[model samples]
Target: MKNITDYSGKCVLVLGLAKSGYETARLLKKLGAVVTVNDGMDLTGNQDAEELITEGITIVDKEHPLSLLETNELIVKNPGIPYSVPILQEAEKKAIPIITEVELAYQINEGTTIAVTGTNGKTTVTSLIGDMFSHSSKKGLLSGNIGFVASKVAQEAEPEDTMITELSSFQLMGVQSYRPHIAVITNIYSAHLDYHGTQDEYVKAKMNIFKNQQSKDYLVFNDAQRELLELYTVNSKVIYFSTVRPTNGAYIKDDAIYFQEELICRLNQIVLPGKHNLENILASIAVCKLSGINNEAIIATLTSFEGIKHRTQYVTTIDGVKYYNDSKATNTLATKFALDAFNVPVHWLCGGLDRGNGFEDLDDHVKCVERMYIFGQTIPKLIDFAKKHDINYEMCHDVKDAVSKTAKFTKHGQVVLLSPACASWDQYPTYEVRGEDFIQQVKSME
Candidate 1:
């Protein structure tokens, strides 16, 4: 591995002491970079922050110190910190380069990186791609959004290893000169409006993943996302994947997954459900084929690839009523897809912190659902919408109560689905925690 310039004695400001922030500070300190960690919240109860402080890293919490920005030569920013933040604005004015954890990892690795970014299906595609490469002779590292920051993985990755990263729009926003050899945008939908302010801005943020790619690199996108595809101005070799089989790139035809180069997998044999997943499978096929994996390996791996849990995961049948934990559906479009995937009468558990989303798009599913169990901060708005549409609905204080009530209301041949069409921050730390709580509550009924 090439030893890049040592950060020895360079002042680095690490903002937002979350997992990525703390990891950056630790790595910077190890590389001899003078690091000051700053978070806007106190570390009285945060174990992660306490651990970093114990390691002798300078800690600033409760508020971001303007002085920290003034003295720093480089700012390692968490994706959560918007560019509009006063401290970041000041840093920009002073001409200090603001870098994200992914960029830092990219600079250090300087190897082949395959980044996956989209409003939905990114995690599934990223994992599937990583699995394909890992199953083959090539070593691969799976990180970013799915789990672990890229910087942490790059520390251990070999030069020949491929990094299959699931990047969020927020992470892509802060990236500069971080080009991936293979970049895939599965699909774009209305999401994170609160952070990006508008759909256009959010789409632009996702597009940044391919902004630096050259003609030699590969850019995979869903032909279905017409608006998103039209925005790309890069000269990279483009590949399109679609659920409705296309003439070129990767596509599905007659229940079979195909690449432009060869047939990959029989789509009917795939264990993962939903039309959305077929598109994800297509993206994975494109990535695998481009990386030189044979058709036999792609089909074998996908046939055995059980879908990720908490994502349209089947919970159990209690008193003949099936329950699915789709707590990962944190956006209206995702929940819409989930609802469409099932034809049975649905006791839809929906509501959470509203990300400026509306319920109008869900009217078709709302009609199909037997009843709606609304919870979290957005319950009132959902309830109001239901009332206006004459949809049957009830409110619960939390997810457990919602699940309990849903089990009671459901009957034989019916499904109780926890597909909150909004963010889970109102009631849980993450969608995973919310999904786990739902699973536990449902299992307790049996």
Candidate 2:
């Protein structure tokens, strides 16, 4: 693979004018490369793209012209663009190399990268690791498939800096030579199958994080993620983390977090609740141990790390009823964690854009839940499942209506939980937006 420094004076085509795309163009231009930005969205109406155009960067909107590919040294593709796209197919046909924003960022940034990839808990784990490094006096930046893009971090990263990147399967699918010094697979499940077309393909995309790592670099995996263990074969150093104590690597033995080298923390003392967070904590501790961070510092940070919002976040207690905003539970496995964490009579608020999730996994937990209030696009399917299981359920048109109805049905001692096991795109822009909306509705109930 050609290093990014070798691209000086080379013509490059940056496909997709998203933040990452625009940043790639800017970075390439600064490196003395002729950069052209291509996006499917119209620039005449896009304020972001218009601002970039005013800066003298060449912009191609609506459609990508084949001529642009003919003149470029490489294509820095946005992950949102499918590999099956005709333009990309044509680029491949012509033997033009294509890379993702992550690949580009990795090439330019002269620092050790610790990438976190999984079906869930990536953001939480990434943030925790970043916080750990920050407290340890290590210069660290968090970016990637999470809200912060790698381009933003790459712009400021120095040689001694460490980067914690949260990678999605979509972003990983297009990565060429991007390899993290410490790569972590938190866990994997069926997700983004709609884009990948198969579970195997989705897993393969995630596995790419370790594909390019050298033997000296570390690769971390959850012992519980059997699928990942079965499918992955690596030449790099491998470490395992789990809720149960493993003979090697990091694990929970009795109520404590134990590592092959030393004891990390007592699991019982961990402030974060649920078995799912135990896995996340184990992953973070494993990374910190590998980085030579002291056990005391790791424990101190983990104890105070309150966790990210929208993931089982406590909202308010109204008339003795506690409400939790778990609007980030966009899958059955995630919702299962929320249910497992709470022992109270739960007035569960669930349902949204269904991603072909099998509700069968949630059947037993539904019995524990006092009642379910279904909403958004998946209400009918949830209601049908509820009826089949003889579970008490009610459908609401939206989250606001669901919260209002939940308030009426919930007793003073019961917990009103907004753990929607589906995507929020049907009604809200993002999971954070959905969570904020739920908080607003809960506040209005008083």
Candidate 3:
């Protein structure tokens, strides 16, 4: 993607009127692109569409017609629209340059970018990196999959600034020439299989983060993911972060975070619990060091930075029972980490869209869980695990139901954790919405 300032008279189709699509359409139109927006949802009363209509941008809703691609020079796709979508498949046949909103941001992004892609911890790692920039004299913007769209951030950015982007595999897959000065892969897991179809395709899409990177660019990753080097070709300089080995990157040693023999912070200094979170800190350390940030600010940021919202965020204590909202743990692996973070007996609430996932691995983690409340579409599978382990369990219809049911099981000094090991699409559109609902329900108990 080039730094295109003027799209004057350029024909572009912004597919899907999702957050990224709306932002992309607006930016492109402002730049003088002949932009037409398309979405599968009806635009009858959509306030989002109404705003775009005032700009005179054409809107095609309910269906994606092949004729919409006619005379189009570019297709800026919303990452949420799967590759299997008819329009995207048709775009491929016509050789239209298909790209995500982030790709468009890459074109106009004047600032240096740090792109993070992985199954889990991407949000936490990206937010931690943002804190590193914020706590210091350095300036950067956090956007992308973590909530804010990248195009919106890049539009107002200056060359002196940096963009800390949290990218998903879906977002990365449509990238063509989008290269980050610093690329981070938190860790690859077998997730989003329902969308990507296969683990290989998912991994390939994630590896796209390094595709356009030059030799001078830095690639930060888990030392555990050395297979990323073995599995895919990477030309950028590799910087690793780990709790395992202590070389060529930032790592932990003697309970202190280190960047190649340089001490950043002790484990106790970081307010975030869980060893997985320490890995996030390690990634931030490597990024700050590469960006020329000092150790003091890095350690200071680690000391005060509470975790991201929706992912292990603290809600409140009711009747001495502590509640943590980990609604962002959309997979078994992520929920496993959440469970491992708490050492006390738990009244755990989990379940949601199955996505064809297995909970067999979760059986071991349930040892700390005193009772489990299964929720959403995966109740039967989760119930099987509860029965297998002989752990007390019940079922719920949704997040609100789960939260209310746990109230009955809550005990003083016990933990009530909402670490659903499945996606929230079965109940809520996104994890954030699901998390907010969980927090709301928990608060109502008081």
Q: Candidate 1 — which residues are off by over 4 angstroms?
A: 45-47, 54-56
Name the regions of candidate 2 deviating beyond 4 angstroms: 1-4, 64-68
Evaluate residue 253 in candidate 2 and report its C-alpha lDDT on the 0 to 100 scale.
Answer: 74
lDDT of 2 by residue, 89-168 (tens): 99999999988888878887878789999988998899888888878878789998778879768878888888789998
Q: Could you tell me the TM-score of candidate 1?
A: 0.95
Q: Clashing pairs in model 2?
A: none
TM-score for all predictions?
0.95, 0.93, 0.97
To one decimal, what is the Cα RMSD in angstroms of model 1 from the true structure? Answer: 1.7
Q: Is candidate 1 or candidate 3 better by TM-score?
A: 3
The candidate that achieves the highest TM-score relative to the unseen native structure:
3
lDDT string for model 1 (171-222, tens) is 9988888999999998888899888998989989999999999999999988
Q: Candidate 2 has what TM-score?
A: 0.93
